[model samples]
Target: MRLFAWAALAACICAAPTLAAPQISALGTPAAPTAAASDPQAAAAVRVAMRQETLPPGGSLPEHRQSGERYLYVVAGRLKVSNLVTGEEQVVEAGKMAAEQPGDWHVAVALGAQAATFYVIDRGPADGAATTAANNDGN
Candidate 1:
């Protein structure tokens, strides 16, 4: 009995290293669906992203006007955002936020020579889309 117990203990200890990390899945993967911040589509009626976005070192430009109301929440670093059409600019820090009005033209750049990240929450047209512009998701 003692020998069997010892053998089992040794086997268990040896097996520990072989244990693998589980493959985790969520409601969306940023732009895909798991988390809300990543899913711009959450505000479907307003016209937002259907998923999370990945930015490069320089950052990103507003591909399209958010069409409704939207806030950008910085996740990692700070960003310098410029409204191309209006020539308005602001510095957004980590854990801080910024916004874009409907039909506004904008662009974001990494601050301090470092990369920046943020999640966008877009709200428009009440809970449902009232017009084609607000409902044009992914636009």
Candidate 2:
């Protein structure tokens, strides 16, 4: 009877579903596409994009730039952001936020032992990439 009970417990444990790990997710479409701003004289509506990302400890997003404005909010852990152009650095902690200007080159890294999770809201051309890699030559 005891052997049967142990086997049943093992089977139940093995059959349990595994939890999925959290990951970055980008949702929805941009409100205005870059092409929509083709007319220089026309007032174009800005596009908005939102995404959530998780950076492993010591991991980093390389030097990059966005075509529009970006706002970052740290959800968990700590984030170290550096401006490649100006050589300025800022540490954003959980519950804190930071802003990035259009065409600004910057890099973000996860600080400390724990991974960091953050949300990004970007406003720019509707169809533009969230970020573009910048030339590494201190340019």
| Candidate 1 residue-wise lDDT, 1-139, digit = tens | 2343344334322323224212121111112222223444432222333223446677665545654445566766677777666677788777665666556555677766567766655544544342223222555
lDDT of 2 by residue, 1-139 (tens): 2343344334322322332211112111222333323443222333555667899999997677876656677888999987666676889898776766557677899999999998766654445664454656745
TM-score per candidate, chains pooled: 0.51, 0.62
Clashes of 2: 1
Given candidate 1, what's the lDDT at residue 23?
Answer: 19
The 10-residue segment of model 1 with minimum total lDDT is 21-30
lDDT of each: 0.50, 0.61
